[model samples]
Target: MLIGVLLVISWLILLIRYPTKALPISMAALAGLALVASWVLWEENRDARYLAHLELRLSYDPQQCPGDRPLAVRLKNGSDAALLELRWEVAAYRPGNATNLAQRLYESPRYSGPGELLPGASWNDCLPLPDLRSGYRPSTLEFRAERLQGQFIR
Candidate 1:
């Protein structure tokens, strides 16, 4: 909003100062600024729009044998964009605890699908515990994918 106001004010000042040249210069400048602003807005929001359709699920699976990955992971993509990669931040907390006891990051090397995760595809797998501490059990688990830097095919 401020930018729009400033641009208008500057254009008006230029028009008053140099009536002949101001029209062409101001038009060119405004056109360039508009193009740059649109590109920036599109780049910033494209990822978020695609990621909004991603569904993630996590659980602690004790049935898995010890020394094996115990965190169950299920991800579904409901958008039309194909995801080239994904990363998640996992957090574990004791029951009724506000503070997390452990945290880890998981990065998917490849999609379970034949290629990049296509639209409406799902991936299921298990992840290792954040820590190797014996008898560690977290009643509360959390997953965050805010750092999704993956390539998307629209």
Candidate 2:
């Protein structure tokens, strides 16, 4: 559908440029449309491949780890296939606090490893949490899992 529209527009431009020429307009239209259609197909295939390669599941033991102790996070592969180069982070936040205190414990970006996870497999890592102010409590911990962009291919 998009290819047909682009081909029509391309032919209109060609007609405007060579009004007096008796050249084959259909050939020009087909060539232009083929190039655009090929590009669109290639892009769609690449995106599908990328989505299929992503298969990381993240969870925690307590859901909300205490600020006074080390935090444990579990990373699992939810897909039937294995995932390569899995990386994750555990972000602990104090409830209703406007400031970002998790940075004080774990660095801005934490490194896991270059390992493979089979179907229904998981890995656990313990990260120390930053001490809170007197009487302060944490609301929740957020875990994010993903393949370091462009670091590995499935």
Candidate 3:
């Protein structure tokens, strides 16, 4: 921040003392600033579209990896940035019928680890589910990361 201010002051002083030479410098700086800002905004906007295209696949055999989720999610970085600080949610619910509404049974905390989700790359792992009664089923699951969003419904 200090360096940026100093650079701006220097540039302004040059512009005042040598107007012709400083015009090119000023133009170049403006172009560079616009380029950086546009790039940053593009990246930020893309984040809102995260997880929107997340793909999911599963192989469940309750018999294997008991008390565990059998779900796998694939995230293809279709953007120009890396994803980090990723987390997810797993929810279990009892189907609703008659006068009963869907009953929430389990929800996991933000699960995170195993490095940054990079551009054009993917990360995957299986997480354990809480012991549950037969009446409940894994209902909805979601994942989040920088500019990412995805959910699985069963």
If candidate 2 were superposed on the true structure by all CA atoms, what would the RMSD be?
8.6
lDDT of 3 at 139: 43
lDDT of 1 by residue, 1-154 (tens): 9999998799789899998999888789889999999998997688778877888776777575244666677788888989886665555555565565453334423223223788998987776656523455544455333345555777
Between which residue pairs do clashes occur in model 3?
Answer: 47-147, 50-147, 50-148, 50-149, 51-148, 51-149
Global local distance difference test of model 1: 0.67
RMSD of candidates 1 onward, in order? 6.4, 8.6, 9.2
TM-score of each: 0.60, 0.40, 0.42
Q: Tell me the tens digit of each residue's lDDT in model 2 across 8-124.
A: 788778778887562575668679999999999986675455435554433344445554334555555555555566444434444455554444343344646437766566676
How would you order the candidates by lDDT, starting with the best? 1, 2, 3
The superposed Cα distance between candidate 1 and the true structure at residue 119, in angstroms, equals: 0.8
Residue 90 accuracy (lDDT) in model 2? 39
Question: Model 2 shows how many backbone clashes?
Answer: 0
Give candidate 2 misplaced runs (Cα > 4 Å). 1-69, 95-100, 104-109, 130-154
Best by lDDT: 1
Q: By lDDT, is 1 or 2 better?
A: 1
Which candidate number maximizes TM-score? 1
Please give the lDDT score at residue 144 for candidate 1.
30
